[model samples]
Target: MRKTSLDVTAARVSPALPRRIPRLPGRFPRRLPVRQVLCLLPLALVAVVAVQHWTVLTEGFGKLGTGEWPWLLAAATTTCLAWVAAAVTRQGAVVERMPVFRLLATQFAAGAANHLLPTGLGASAVNLRFMTVCGIPLARSSAALALYILAEAISRVTLLIALLLAFPSALRLSTLLPEGAVGPLLLAVAVATVVAAAVLLLVRRLRTAAVSFLRTALGEARSVHTRPARALALWGGSLAFPALQAAGLVAVGQALGLQIPAAHMAVAYLAATVAVALVPTPGGLGSVEAALIVTLVAAGGDAAVATAVVLTYRIITVWLPLLPGALTLGVLVRLKVI
Candidate 1:
């Protein structure tokens, strides 16, 4: 009777052992959620970029000790203020009032994202997500984004034009380009515009979308500008954003003892930024550096000093904030704030 009872106990437990074993394999093979993976991707890309640019970043830091500390401190201050300017502009773009603290944090994260993705996509994506979460409709959020971008670009270009006018000798446009290059460049731009327009006209779906987007964007722009405070914040912040960026570059130039006049340095910074705006590089990383070095040299700065200045400026504005920004982005994502 004892042996029979023992046999029954073994039989009952044996079946449950196989079920538990199967669950172990299932746990080992479990996959991460797609949303989680996507959320983490930007941080991963930023890490890869940092590794790739590690040597340049180290060299940039090496020159920092020799730089004028006061100017570098000013540059750092200006960089922080630029983020505030961006947050203000973002708030002005949409009618809904975002929580000020959250808005600023989003902009900080957006800046980090901007360096990870090309052509400002990361920043745009983060802002769109944030706005959507803040209860804005998708179309209106998108339209607001477009308006913000348009305002920023227009303000930057207007500032550049005004600066060029104020200091006429700051940039010699004719000498900056090769002989006979202007006409061809203009013609090519016109032809490309025509081609793009034709393609838009030929595609019915794209044409409809474009028209809808433009109408929505115009409506949003009108609504945002109807309020005096919003209008002022929108345009004023936009104007100050680029000015601060250029000022940072100037401060860096001063720190490195670059002989370029402050006004000329500002012009060079603006021109290089505008020229490389279409390069599609992440935060205009490599391209901006090259363009800055070349433009500064053209503006009568020594090539070696210009290179060092650009590197130092980028390190202060980009590298220092990168890790913090990435961490903010991750926290925001986990919290569903963006």
Candidate 2:
């Protein structure tokens, strides 16, 4: 297939940004250059997060001042380190060893990008671009992305199950259930899965592409697992990323005096996130807060306190990182580091 302009532009690996920009004839430097816009878009979207949550940000600052300082500090610390965990997992996704600092930077930038784009499209695009800039082939880069996602999903579910089993009796799991809702919900989910599977199998082109993509992804997964260090990093980082996120939530819960056990809080966090994982909101924005608050309240926390905990957790994790992460993203793009 002939390469499109984007393919050609992306193929050029250089220290400077790719010249995919179009110049207007007799232009006065084109008031807003494409490159500037490209870099600014992520920043703008990220800044919108803070703007939308200005009340929460202000309230959160006041809470942090009055709330338990140590726990809030711990929450902030874990949130920052989640990016490092993500970077490690990204490294493990492919056989090639990316520059550590750049990879770390990319993950941080990806976080900012993830805020506005639904279902993680922003982060995925940024990471895919970074892989291409690092000279990885498009197919391999795609496979690597698939592997990272697969690992993350598996690890999250695994951790959730483990935690639930360990504290099953204490978690008041029944409170969250709408009495007979489980059976119907399960049936609905199963029906949807069946429908999706049927569609994939019935459509020849879709089936063929799906099979090919699976083959590539599986081959990449096998390759990654063969290296012990890589395998450890992949699985370890995947587990750590969500675990840290849950820990951050737990710390916030403690800081806000949420009347729930730490183990129960962790279980609630994981359960809420897993339940809303498929919701097509950016970083599970609205869905996550609603689900988490519900889960915490079901797990014996006061409703108002649960609301406070969830909002504060998001303020610390998402809002706090937006600006710096956006700056990092802009810098990475300006340096052609993707």
Question: lDDT values of the candidates?
Answer: 0.92, 0.89
The best candidate by lDDT is 1
Candidate 1 lDDT: 0.92
Off by over 4 Å in 1: 1-28
Candidate 2 per-residue lDDT, tens place, 1-338, comes to 88898877766745377458766688754477777788887777776876786787798666666568899999999998999999999999999999999999899889988877886788999999999999999988999998999899999999999988889854676777878999999999999999999999999999999999899899999999999999999999999999999999999999989989998999999999899888998878888989998899888999988888888898889877878888999889888898
Q: How close is candidate 1 to the true structure, as a TM-score?
A: 0.91
What digit string (tens of lDDT, one per residue) describes model 1 on residues 1-338? Answer: 36797799999898878564346555566788766876687678888999999998899999887899999999999999999999999999988899999999999999999998897898999999999999999999999999899899999899889988999888666657999999999999999999999999999999999999999999999999899888988999999999999999999999999998999999999999889888998998999999998888888888899999999999999999988898898888888898
Error of 2 at 67 (Å): 1.4
Which ten-residue region of model 2 has the weakest summed lDDT? Answer: 10-19
Off by over 4 Å in 2: 1-31
The candidate 1 region of ten consecutive residues with least summed lDDT is 18-27
Error of 2 at 143 (Å): 1.0
